[model samples]
Target: MSALQVGLAVAGGLLLGGVIAWETWNARRRAPRQPVPERRPPAPEEGERVEPGVASALPTADDERLEPGFDTAPGALSPLGPVPAPEKRPRLDALIDVIAPIALDGRVVSGDAALAALPATRRVGSKPFAVEGRNVLTEEWEFPIAGQRYDALQAGVQLANRTGPLNEIEYSEYVMKAQHFADALGGAPEFPDMLHEVARARELDEFAATHDAQLSFTLRARLTAWSPGFVHQQAARLGFTAGAIPGRMVLPAEEPGLPPVLGLVFDPRAALSEDPEQSAINSLALSLDVPQVHRNARPFGRLRDVAFALAEVMDGEITDDTGQPLRTEMIDKIGQDLAQLYDTLDAHDLAAGSPQARRLFS
Candidate 1:
């Protein structure tokens, strides 16, 4: 109730209010707050100024296009562009490089005559010897064996492995044979390096590997529809002889030292009926296995003719491996391809179906 007591109470209340306000302000200042994020500049447009060493990291329009014959993966860049593949060589060519030829001269007689006079008992390695011929009137001789005729005068006898290179023993035996032939002909024996010939052979072999092709024509019929005797008769008319196998008939090679190019195959395992009139043939396959280096157009033409004849006689359709009917245009196209191959071989002085080609390609 005293005036001094009332004034003391008011001062106490005022002091309490001021202390509470100060405490609230201190709590708010100590509380944690979220952090602010940083911002980056926008990328420059094409032709715009960019920092040095930074432009190389950016992609260009050409990076999206791929080079020819090149394969690329997604999200990856190839450091080097497409590279060409290396060429392949034949195994025989490398083997022939170490070989040399042993030559025996025929003084007065022809090379062929001297070669033919050689003793049958004499063995000059497993490989056959090739004879080089010269004109009786002129001293010059043909370079290629194909251009020379069988009746040409014999000048020298060469014991070399035209098909493959000779080994140590084989080379020694060939040298011995050359010496013997030289003594018989009363002339000196000479040895020549075959590096040039070996190089030519290699080129021919590579060409063959690139262009080799095989064609087959098949005729299918119901089971027990062709008799073996009838098939043999038909084949005989087409100049086909029974092969080593019972069901196989092969066309004879046009020249000696060459293998058969075409063959007729029949299924001999088919059931046979007791009736003589019934047929026992199942299927017939006509195949032309042409040599890559020595093939000519004649073989392909003959093959087509024989296929047509057999198809007509058997009352069957000619088809490919996929059983699709073969059209005449397809066969004509094959013939054209064969002609082109022959021309290419001839241009390189390696005529197809020639004796030299046969010997080298063998």
Candidate 2:
């Protein structure tokens, strides 16, 4: 072969080999094989269930135990229901229980206005009376303290006698009488060796004459010292009224040519032994001829009247039973009424000590 022919023939052979290699490469790329999926384990034989235990998975009685007859379902109530209803509370009696502290066969006492005007006495002291259904009893002074409650009212009276415009002789007589009363009853620890300052006064014919005729001088013995502060005022409000003595040896304060020494006589035993609050409230109702409203009753015109009456009595502005200057020592009674009124207002959320009430004294 010639040199040129040999070179051309070599080139053609390389070209043909290249074309055949390209076709083979293209066919291999287009027809490449895919990977096989993973195989799972073989299924179990028919009716061949695997048993891990012999009924050991079931819950025992202890697992779901509950209270007797108790329902475990959602929102279920227990079989043990509430107890049966208790007996109803008894109703309050109007005649017997309505009177509370005041009762028949009771004595009525009295005191001065300034002596009875302390508001603290009303708050700190006992109710002096309660309306437990209807049976009233005025002997509640020893309620908070064993029989020492009278001392508070007596102290109040003494304070009024000392600071107020009451005369020295009268004040002294009042204190002495109180001391004697306490002594007769056995003196308190505070007033041990207490003497009856009013002994001499009581011995005076005038004292006997002016004192309650139904009660002997010995009854005065039962009477503790009640100047104003030293005793409960409730006793007085429902007890005594200002007026001429009906048939006593003494004349009334309004009586013409009456002795100045014979001040008004206060007899606490005159009224029924009832709660002074209820007594005052009832008496106030009677005084105004109004109905007895509950303590929570509103529109306090009746209460206002009671307050005004009380304030007038306290300020010595209230006329006596006979339309004369109020000479009877009845501030104790007024204070009792006031305490009830205050309690009533408080219970009802009423305004306390209304303007008319204040103006009555002013």
Candidate 3:
């Protein structure tokens, strides 16, 4: 029993104690995880609600409500169940019921009757230069043309009185009247009212006379009596500048007093040729064989169609200061197309006094 024996005995006792503690720790570590929650039995139909783990398996508040505009209740059938083949609306009947009228000027003119039967072109006075068809009555515009503040309706009436079956004479009278009005109003001051009307008239007359055709239609009347200032105002609204329009004037006759009158007509035609919207008007006129002062106006209508289509294409990309896109391309294309179309039209001799001619001439 020396010190070595005593140390070995103490070490054995310590090792045995450590083994017992290790066994206790291992037994605690091996205890089973807590048992998973068991599902409770579903409540009776008339009792408390049961929760579902998956949302799809449970009925929602909306599912229980009845579908609007349907006969079946919700939950009983699909909420959107074969959407009762949309009760078709009586479209034709509705159209007939709420049918609209063809409004001209301030009054309703036609409904179901053929437009041809209705006196579309009517002589206001006994004179041949009468308002035909659906000439819209406009508020009288006062302007200086020759040397007076003249109104187109008044001038038209005067021309009718002065000329009997003399369309040229009547037209001349219009020029004289406009000239007199212009002179009287101080020779092109702030606003020139007869710019479009007089200008268009002179051009049409000259062009028609050259082509051996007669100018006819509400358009003719509108031009003969259009207020240049009013036209400029309208142009401004459409994003064009309101001022003296730049143009190349082409006279109808080589008379002393005729140059200014012809210039009036020529300028508008050139200006209109540059406008995208008005370009189509020219084409439509050609297509319909509508008489125009300037033969050049014929191709403008088609150009306008192209311009409008181009504008539609650009949609939101190009816009003005107020979010309006400058239709520069459309306008340019219109001028180019009109030039080409004019060349083609010019090549083919416009039949003089044919059925196409007679309708306008006669």
Candidate 4:
């Protein structure tokens, strides 16, 4: 080839390569930044012992199960990080529920039979209606599981909850469901007197009303509004994860099955937007359902700290539900009040974060 032609060819190739590189850089610059996953510490060079870390993104379709780090019990720690154990829900208690015994004709029922006979909804007029069987082998009360034989079964409905005390209608519905449940299993249910249970429910409800305390603070953008990505990214840095619902992020409790320690919620529409980056979010709420979290988790402290931190990072101002900007003194006062409330709950034996408290508040 001629020298002139060769030179021209070389220049053409260089120009094409430069254009491709420029396009690649520009595309990346325009693309929304993704969350940077919090990497877990490396395992002891032995092998793949999945040491789960803070979840940064939703699990892919192929994920085998709720990624590990949740099987551990509350407050329990491991070498890697906090492995919040899944909570084994509390069983039936006569103090909190109206109990009824099901006579199984002295005949042990198979687990499948018991499960099949239980009520389908597991709820009776805003109260939790549940059935538990006495394990034939261990004599322990539990929800019937496969491969077990049950010698006895009991049904109960919660006496009171945040919604208020169980009334006559709810008690009657409980009775009907429990009776039907027993009949389906060829057994008979002996329920407590509706009047007595209703009275007990009212008393319990009064006590719960005095103790229940849920705190929330709104974080409003001070100057520049934030994108959904900015909010989520900041929360993730503070050990938050994407919750099941949109616009909701949570700092998971040390106990897995229990409700989250603290929750942050903004605009659900923004979360549902086709391009979250383009959505501007001006305000979000940080909340703590006091009774739902254990005292040891220091949920109140975390709520306060997170609110302050987010406000600082996101250039926001913290305010009450009434929209009045909260000063530091106001926050401290609320903490003091929370402490007193905790004392009250503890005195009633429904200490915050206990299963009973969680159930009652819920």
- Who wins the lDDT comparison? 4
The local distance difference test score of model 3 is 0.29
138-214: candidate 2 lDDT, tens digit per residue: 54332222222232233212111111222335444434443443343333313211123233222322321321111
Tell me how far the alpha carbon of residue 251 in candidate 3 is from the true structure, in angstroms, after superposition. 37
lDDT of 3 by residue, 1-362 (tens): 99999999999999999999999977554431222233555665986676666422112234322122221111122232221111121111110011111222233222122222223332323332211122224333221122222122212321111112224444444345333433432332121233443344444445444433221111121111222333333222222232355422121211222111111121355345544222212111111222222332222332233223222221212232243343657545645644554344345332321222222333
Question: Model 4, range 1-362, lDDT digits (tens) per residue?
Answer: 99999999999999999999999988665444444556675556666576666644433323333222232122333343443344485889887889999998899998998888877798999999899999989999999898899999999999999889999999989989998889889888898888988999999999889778889999998766677888898787667889999999988876558788888998999889998876778889999999887766777776876787677667689999889999989998998999899888888888787778878888
Worst 10 residues of 3 by lDDT: 90-99
Which has the better lDDT: candidate 1, or candidate 4?
Answer: 4
Off by over 4 Å in 3: 1-121, 124-193, 213-356
Give the deviation of candidate 3 from the true structure as CA RMSD. Answer: 33.2
Best by TM-score: 4
lDDT of 2 at 101: 26
Candidate 4 local lDDT, residue 116: 84
Cα deviation in Å at residue 79, candidate 2? 50
**Alpha-carbon lDDT of model 2:** 0.28
Taking all chains together, the TM-score of candidate 4 against the true structure is 0.76
Q: Residue 303 of model 1: what lDDT?
A: 74
* Pairwise TM-score winner, candidates 3 and 4: 4
Worst 10 residues of 4 by lDDT: 65-74
> Model 2, clash count?
64
How far residue 89's Cα lies from its native spot in candidate 4, in Å, is 3.6
